[model samples]
Target: MSKVVLITGASSGIGKSIAVFLVQKGYKVYGTSRSPKNIENYPFELIALNVLEIATIEKAIDFIIAKEGKLDVLVNNAGMGITGPVEDTPTVEMKAVFNTNFFGAIDVMKMVLPQMRKQKSGFIINVTSIAAYMGLPYRGLYSASKGALELVTEATSMEVKKFGIQVVAIAPGDFATNIAAGRYHTPVFENSAYKENYQLNLDVMDAHVDSGMHPDEMAKAVYSIINVTKPKIHYKVGDFMQKFSIVLKRVLPDRVYEKLLMNHYKM
Candidate 1:
């Protein structure tokens, strides 16, 4: 039987791209949106699942299990982005982003694990960000949320490996997606100390996404990871420099790396 796959946040962007690609590859794909309705022309089915809502998560997982008998893979890709100076960004907003990007993904995994455990075979792919490897100016909260998920991915992999469930994280650099529209942007208050710098980085961030790699590249990476016999705990998909930044963080002096990031963002 073809693999049964469920991808969260699949209405558009990277999630949608992965869903479409997997469908073409002959997997039974079920993509999700918070409100899936009246959408069409897709080979895979779209279900209702909001990572922030436990009921929706449970419903979606149960629906897939009831129909497919067993879910073979889950792409935990439903996440929101936030960008603002850490001090100026509302504490509540930071918590909300973490709730979605971090706790929300964990909730979905928790709901899906029992079923996978019973089957003794499954793959869980947590969609993270290359930004997770290092904190970036104006995008610190976004980085922290995804970074937290990356750690959880590692711990979960070791915890579940004995049960035949494979868990891994795939961190992608900027990709051409509608993520910018969904992100919560703290306004560039005229009087705020970070106003000018924040505005500059906002433009920089948008430009990066506008010119970033196509989502198809990430889809292909996910497909490859799915087919591997023993996938690594973490994988990154991005341009040479984006991926290399992680390595630089490891080898470069703390202040040196800080200077590089500051210069990159023109801080």
Candidate 2:
């Protein structure tokens, strides 16, 4: 029997690339997006899903189960980016970011795990970001959200190990995706206390993202993890910058690392 995999946020970017690659490699891939209208004639199934919507998530999962009869993998890839200072970002926007990035992913995992436990086998890959490790100038919310995801993946991996289900997280750094373009830039402050500094930080992040690696690299890493016999709990894939950032986070003092990151963004 062919293995089945469900990927969210598949309309474009890394999720779409993974879906195409996995389908070509002969997995029964189910690619999901908030709307399926724009994506057509794909090698595998395309389902409509908004991770924040419980009905949509349930419907998409039911569709997959009815069609495939077994769920072998779940890729919690649907997420959005919110960039701004922690204190300056609106509470609503922060909640929205967590809704899609952290809680949304958790919802999918919660729904899928029961089925995987029944089958006694499955893999869940949470697509995280290197921002989980390093906090950038205007990306406090984004970084915090991903940091939460990393912790979730780690804890869940251990929890599910006894159930024959594997959970893993992929933290890719600076992928060339629409996230950088589509990012919601919240006001750094309502009082305009740091407008000039905030704008400079945004510009710095914009340039860094513009020069990031292509999304296909991340897709390839996803494929590799899915095929592995014993997948890692966390995989960090990206350029030298990403590795350096993670290393710094591990070895440097919090204040020292903050200075380094601040200097990187010229803030």
Best by lDDT: 1
Number of colliding residue pairs in each model: 0, 0
**Candidate 2: residue 71 lDDT (0-100):** 97
Model 2 lDDT vs. the true structure? 0.87
- Off-target runs (Cα >4 Å) in candidate 2 are 188-191
Stretches of model 1 off by over 4 angstroms after superposition: none
Q: For residues 175-214, write the lDDT of model 2, one tens digit per residue.
A: 7777776788886564777788888877777787788888
- Which pairs, if any, clash in model 1? none
RMSD values, in order shown = 0.7, 1.5
Query: What TM-score would each prediction reach against the true structure?
Result: 0.99, 0.95
Tens digits of per-residue lDDT, candidate 1, 1-267, equal 999999999999999999999999999999999998767766789988989989999999999999989999999999999999998999999999999999999999999999999999999999999999999999999999999999999999999999999999999999999999999999898889999999999999999999999999999999999999989999999999999999999999999999999999887
Weakest 10 consecutive residues of candidate 2 by summed lDDT:
37-46
